[model samples]
Target: MKPAAFDYHRPDSVEEAVSLLAELGEDAKILAGGQSLVPMLSLRLAFFDHLIDISRLDELKGIERRGDALWIGAGTTDATVGADRQVSAAVPLLTRVTPFVGHFQIRNRGTFGGSIAHADPAAEYPTVALTLDAVMEAVSPRGRREIAAADFFTGLWETALEPDEVLTGVRFPLSNSRSGFGVHEFARRHGDFAIAGSVVAVRLEEDRVSHCAIGLMGLGSTPRRAAAAEAAVLGMPLGELDPKQIGELAMSGLDDVPADLQGSASYRARVGAVMTARAWTDAVAEAGGEATHA
Candidate 1:
């Protein structure tokens, strides 16, 4: 199958892109890396009357730090993000999770903002963004605004972005010296979408867990914060934490786990528990806290 006929507009600047989007309205789709959008178009899963190519817009093409957060351009590729020294230092969880995104070729073409905009429930970037409370910046002819990661994702492949808005970039809060991160997922093969996954960020204060954030993927309509699990480990001594118990708590509130050929809802819930536990345990260790369980 091939995508329906469409007009192509490549804008050199974000202002031009926003103007095009505003003019084209619902008929326009912003083309970034094309990693996910192209496939959907080719399969007839999606169609647009116009494609506004912002892939080369200079405004969306760098990795930089501003104040307390690291800002990543919407056009930055996954491979570039994974290899960036600044990202490795400021948001290590992104570095740790990027390798699991897709194959090398996919990573080379997949853009950070594209994945987030696509909003796949099992995508690595969204899970990381949610766990870190990343903020998404979007622009339209009307104006510009920021959307919190927690409120950005509305459902599978759906986001808070208005039809005329183009995501410009995302900002991730820098992790402190006492922070550690870990991510774990179950996929039948490398490069495949995860069947279930977990991302954990732990902040230690005086050998006690001060802050914990757990994000669960591939188990619901959108990547979900494991609130129950995060609350469970608060103020607990690192060594005394039980991975099994933490894992159970993570899945306790997952009532809408998806079921497909990959697995049943019950199966995914079970795998989710295991992944959550492993992620939590490894995150604690990475944060310089001792973990008794392997």
Candidate 2:
């Protein structure tokens, strides 16, 4: 099925894009790489009367750093972000999981900001953002505002973005310790959406697990942060975290996950726990002998 009829407006600048969105209101949708939206439109799963194309907005098209944080433009493609050494060094999470987003052709057109705004529960970037505690920068006729990654996704295919607001970029903070990151996902095919996935980030302070962040996708209504699980591994030696203990903590926070045809609540919860446990083990190994088990 083809998408319903819609008007397409490609703006050359950010201000113009925001203006178009404000003018179109409920009928408009922002078009970035068109990787996700186009497929939705073709399947008739999404309906928008207007398409505000921001591909030409040069202002929203770069990656740079300020202090310890890296700011990636919303319009920047995933391929670009994945290939940049700066991003890989600053936020290894972005580099580690970007290759799994889709095929190479899709990655060439998939935009970073677009994925976050789309808020697909199975998307890797949202899980990464949640794990990193990134911030999304958006602009609208009302004003500019920043939304925390954790607070951005209200539900599956829903976000905190107002109708007139356009996401401009995402800001990721650099770790202050010898941090190691890992992203893992299980899929039937190479480019298919994940059945279950996890992104783990561990920060070490003098050979001890100082801070840990774990985020899970394809197991909940939204990309979820395993807060209880994070707390479980903090200050514990990597070898000390028994699989059963970590699994219990990880599953503890998935009480509200939704069930679907692809997986039951129980199955997804189990996958979430398993993936997170593996990620924690991998991250701990990367920390060398500093990882402790008790």
TM-score winner: 1
Which parts of model 1 have CA positions greater than 4 angstroms off?
none
Q: Model 2 segments beyond 4 Å from truth?
A: 290-294
**Each prediction's number of clashing residue pairs:** 0, 5
- Writing each residue's lDDT as its tens digit, candidate 2 over 139-233 gives 99988999999789998789999988999999999855577776778777888888888888887766667998888888777888878888866
lDDT of 1 by residue, 1-294 (tens): 899999999988999999998888898999998989998899999999999998887779899999999999999999999999999999999999999989999999889999999999999999899989999999988899999999999998999999889999999999898888889999999989999999999999999999999999899999999998888789988778888889988999778999999999999999999998899888888889887675
TM-score of each: 0.98, 0.95
User: What are the Cα lDDT values of the candidates?
Assistant: 0.92, 0.83
As for candidate 1, its clashing pairs are: none
Best prediction by lDDT:
1
Q: Mind sharing the TM-score for model 1?
A: 0.98
User: Whole-model lDDT for model 2 versus the true structure?
Assistant: 0.83
